[model samples]
Target: MEVKKKLLDIVRDTVRFKHYSLSTERTYIHWIKHYIFFHNKKHPKEMGKEEIEEYLTSLAIKNKVASSTQNQAFSALLFLYKEVLGVDMSEWNIQALRAQERKRIPVVLTKDEVKLVIENLKGIYNLITMLMYGCGLRMNEVINLRVKDIDLGFDKVYVWDSKSLKDRVIPLPLKLKQRIAVQLEAVSELHAKDIKDGFGAVYLPYALEKKYKNAQFETKWQYLFPAANISTDPRTKIKRRHHILANTLGRNIKVAAQKANLNKRVTSHIFRHSYATHLLQAGIDLRSIQELLGHKSVETTMIYTHVISEMNKAKLISPLDF
Candidate 1:
C-alpha cells in the first residue's frame, strides 16, 4: 500500500476540495507551519489540546499579534485538526486572547477630498478607485470582476461569489460609464491581439475550465483589468494573463492620498467605507445600503449610522458656546 501524503499536501487538497480561496489556503498553511515549528517540528498528530493552547498563547504574549490575527490562527488550527486530521476536538476549550475595546471609526472623505484624491490618481488606478467608491465594492470584488460582469446596457455591475458567497447587482455610476466603455474597447483590442499571438486563454475558478472546453478563449470570461504581461500560473504552469495586483492598486491609492494632502489614513478599503457613510448621510434606507454592501446582517451596515451621526453637527451642543 502507498503511504499517505504529507500534512500540508493533505491540507491543500482539503482546501481545494472545499473551494476555499487561494488566500485562505496560504493563510491556513502559514499558521499550520508555525504551529509545527513552535513545537520543534513535531507532527500535529502528535500534539493535543494543551499544545494548541501553548501555541496560541505564544502568539498573543510573545508575538504580540492582534486579537483578530490570533483568532485566525486559532481557526486555522481548529480546521487542521478537525478536517485534515479527523481529530475529535469537540471538548477543546482553548480561549483566545481578547482584544481590548477599540472605539475605532471608519475614515471617511468629504466630497471635495474624494474629488481631490481622484484628480491625483491617473489612468487605470483612477478608474479602479472610482469603481470601488462609486459602486461600494470591496477591493477583491472589483479586482475579480470579469468582462461579462459589467452590464453597460442595464448600468449595473454583477458581483458573483462575493465575500458573503452571494451574487449582487450594484448600480453603475453614470459618470464613469463612458470611461469604462473606452476601457472595454481597449480590452477588446488586446484580446484580439492575444488571440492572434496564439494565447487568448484566461483562467476560470472552481474547475469551470474543465467544465467548458473552450470557455477560456471567450472574451466574456477575460479579466476586465488584465495584467500588463503574461505570467505562469503557479498551479498549472500555464502562461496566461491575470488581474492587476491588489497590493499595487492599494499602494497607488496611498500615493494619491498623499498628493491630495489628506491627513487621514486613506486606504483602498476606505473608498468602501466612505461609500456607506456618504449614502447614510444622503438618507438612504439602512436595509437598502446593507444589500448593496452585500452584508449578511443589517447590524454590520448600521455602523455607518454611527459615522454619519458623528459627522452631523446638528445634534451637538458645544459647551464653549455657553
Candidate 2:
C-alpha cells in the first residue's frame, strides 16, 4: 500500500483539486504551518476546536495581528478543518478579532491631474495606466490580458476570470487603438524571439492545457504584457514568460505621482476609483457604472456618489438671506 502524503502535501493536492488561485493556496499552507508550529508541531488530526481557538486568541493578543489578518487565519483554519480534514467545525464558537468596518471615501483624481499622471508615464506603463483609468480594470485584470481578449473593431476589452471568478466587458478607449496596435507588434517580436529559444508557452487557466494540445504555443492565449524573461513554471516545469508583475505598475505610478507633484496618495487603484467617480460626475446612472465596474452589487458602485459633484460640496445657506 502507498504511504499517505504528508499534511502540507495533502493540503496542496486539495487546494489544486478545488481550483483555488495560486496566492490562496500559498496563504492557506502558510497559515496551516503556523497553526501546527504554534502548537509545537502537533498534527491537525490530533487537535480539535479548542486548540484552534487558543491559536487564534494568541494571534490577537501576542502577535497583535490586524483584524483582517486575523480573519484570514480564521478562514484558512476553517477550510483546513471542514474541507480538508472532514471535521464538522460549524459548532465551534470562533472568538477571533472582528475586522473594523471602514467607511472612508475613495480617492479620486480630477480630469487634469489624471492627464498629468498619464503624461508622466511612458510606453507600456502609460497604456496600462490609461486602461486602469479609461476602462476601470483592476491591476490583475490588465496584467493577465491575453491577445485574443481584445477587440479593436468593437472597441471592447474582455476581462476574464477576475476576482470572485467573474468576468465582465470594459469599453476600450478610442485613444488607445493606435497605441495598442504598436504594443501588439512589440509583443509579437518578443514572442518570435522566445519561440526561437524553444520557450514560448504561456500558462492557461482551468485545464485549457489539456483541452487544447497546442494552446501553450498559440499567440492568441499569450500574455499581452509578457515578462522581460522566461521562468520555470512551478507546476509543469515549463519555461514561459508570464505577464509582467503588477508591482511594476505600482512602483512606476509612485514615481510618476512624485514627478507630477500631486499632493494626494496615488496608486494604480486610484485610477479605477477615478474611472467610477468620473462617470458619476458625467451623470452616468449607478446601475450602468455598477455593471462597468463589475461590482456584484449597486451598493458597492454607489460609493462613488459620495465623492462626486454636489455630494461632496458644502452649500450652507446664510441666515441673512432668510
Candidate 3:
C-alpha cells in the first residue's frame, strides 16, 4: 500500500475509535510524516525495530529534541504500530536520552501583585484572570467554561472533561457571582444573534454530535466566553462559536503583568500557583486542594507545601528569648 494512503487509513481508524482529540490526530499524523520523510519516504511497515531505534537515537543525538518532544514522538509511533497497524510494539525498545529534571519552583505572584495585575486588566480580560486565581483554573479550563458549568446559586464552578478526562468542581467566589450573572446576560444576547443568523450549532465531542443533534443550539450549551466573532468550524465546516483564543488571552496577560510592574515572570499558570499557595496559607488540606485543581496525584499538590514551609520559616523570633 502507498504510504500516504496507509497513513490516512491509520488516522481514520484512530478517529473512528474516538481515542482522543482531533488535535492529537493532527499531531500524530505530522510526526509520522516527519518520521517517514527522515527515512527518505520508506514505508514504515518495511522498517523494523532496528530502524525505529536509529530514528529515535537520531532525535536525541542529531536533532537534539527535548525529552518531552522525543517522548511525544515515541507515543505517536507506539499508537501508530499498536492501535493503527495492529502490531504490538511491546517487544520493541528504542530509548532517547532523558533530560535532567529541574527542581525550580513555580513562579507565584503575591496577593497584592495579583490585585495589581487584575486592576490593570480591563473588561472581560479582568474577569477571566479573576476567575483563574479565584477558582484556581487552568487557562484552557477557563476558556472552555460553559453556561451550564457554572452554578451561581450554589457558588460553585464545575470543570468537565479536564486534563485526564476527569471532572471536578471548585468554589465560586460570591463577589464574582454578580459579575458572572451580568456576563451571562451578555452571552444570552450574543447567542440570540447567532440563532437569528442561522448559526445555532455548538461543537460537541465526537459522536455526541450525532446523538444530540440539537443540543449545541441550546442556551445551556453556549460557551460562557465565546469568541468575539462567529467562525466556521474547521472539522464540520459549520458556522459556530468557539471559545476565546489562548493567544489573545496570553497577550492581554503579558500587557497586564507589565503594567502592574510585577518582578516575577507572570503568566496564566502563575495565577494557578498563587491560588494553590494562598489556599495552603489559609490552612486548606492538600487533598482538598488537589481535588479543586483536578490533579491526578497528591504528590503534584505537595509542591505547595514548600511555599507554606518557607513562610513559616520567615516568622520573627522574640529578641529577649531565653
Number of the top-ranking candidate, with TM-score as the measure: 1
Tens-digit lDDT track for model 3 on 121-240?
A: 999999999999999999999988998999988899999989867899899988799999999999999999889988867786657777888888898988889999889876658788
Tens digit of per-residue lDDT, candidate 2, span 1-322:
9997898988888888887777889999999999999999999999987788888888888887877788888889988988899998778776654455457799888999999999999878988899778998889889889998888889899998887567888888998888887777788888888889888888988777889979888888888888887888776688789998888889999999999999999988999999988898888899999888888888888888888744556565578878
Ranking by lDDT, best first?
1, 2, 3
Report RMSD (Å) for each prediction in the order shown: 1.9, 2.8, 3.4
lDDT-better candidate, 1 vs 3 = 1
Give the alpha carbon lDDT tens digit for every residue of 1-322 in model 1: 9997999999999998887888999999999999999999999989998898888888888888887788899889988999999999988777655444355678889888889899999989999999999999999999989999999999999999998997999999999999989888888889889999989899889888899979999988988888889888876789888888899999999999999999999998888999998888788999999999999999988888888878876677899977
CA shift of 168, model 2, Å: 0.8
Worst 10 residues of 3 by lDDT: 93-102
Clashes per candidate (backbone, < 3 Å): 0, 0, 0
* Regions of model 3 farther than 4 Å from truth: 1-9, 12-19, 309-322
The lDDT leader among the candidates is: 1
Alpha carbon lDDT of residue 292, candidate 3? 93
Q: For each candidate, what TM-score against the reference?
A: 0.94, 0.90, 0.89
Q: What TM value does model 2 have?
A: 0.90
Model 3: lDDT to the true structure: 0.84
